[model samples]
Target: MAFKLPVHCPSCETMLSVSQLSCPECSTVVSGNYDLPLFLQLTRDEQDFIMQFILNSGSLKEMAAQMGNSYPTVRNKLDDIIGKINQLKNKNGKDDD
Candidate 1:
């Protein structure tokens, strides 16, 4: 099963940071303030689009067909995601990768 990661606080629009991580097997926990990756900071829908894009062999035309959208629309969506990622990288002053 897939769990969605919450990237923002519900009450405020401010960006959120990860403060802890746990190991399910060893029952060990690690904690610290960490920013979400540029990709994870994107909206869920955008993440899904990226997954679909990869599954389609990086073909926007294939993604459009699978998503029932026009090729241009799919390309535009990808372009928008790229812009957001660039902005995030600039804001962080580092590459999320």
Candidate 2:
């Protein structure tokens, strides 16, 4: 069975970094601390919500119907996601500056 990539420490709930990668064909290995993309930092539920939103062609009404929620509810969720993304972008921008 395939496992989902872990974004946090299973034991202490700390953030995790990629320490190594291996090539399947050549058995080559590389090691380093790596950061996850901004999107990967989102909760699994949020990621699923994004996938659903995309599959519905960005229709909040469709998402609301599919999720058995009101349009406002779906919109609020989308707004929350947007806020998170904006916060991450701002943080990254600040880091660059």
**Top candidate, metric TM-score:** 1
RMSD of 1: 1.6
Across 15-91, the per-residue lDDT of candidate 1 in tens digits comes to 89999999999999999999887888899999998998888899999888888999999999999999998998999
Write candidate 2's Cα lDDT for 1-97 as tens digits. Answer: 9999899999999767778999999999999987667788788999999999999999999999988999999999999998887887786564421
TM per candidate: 0.90, 0.81
| lDDT at residue 13 of model 2 (Cα atoms) | 92
Separate clash counts for every candidate: 0, 0
For model 2, the local distance difference test gives 0.87
User: Least accurate stretch of 10 residues (summed lDDT) in model 2?
Assistant: 88-97
- Sliding window of 10 residues with minimal summed lDDT for model 1: 88-97
The lDDT leader among the candidates is: 1
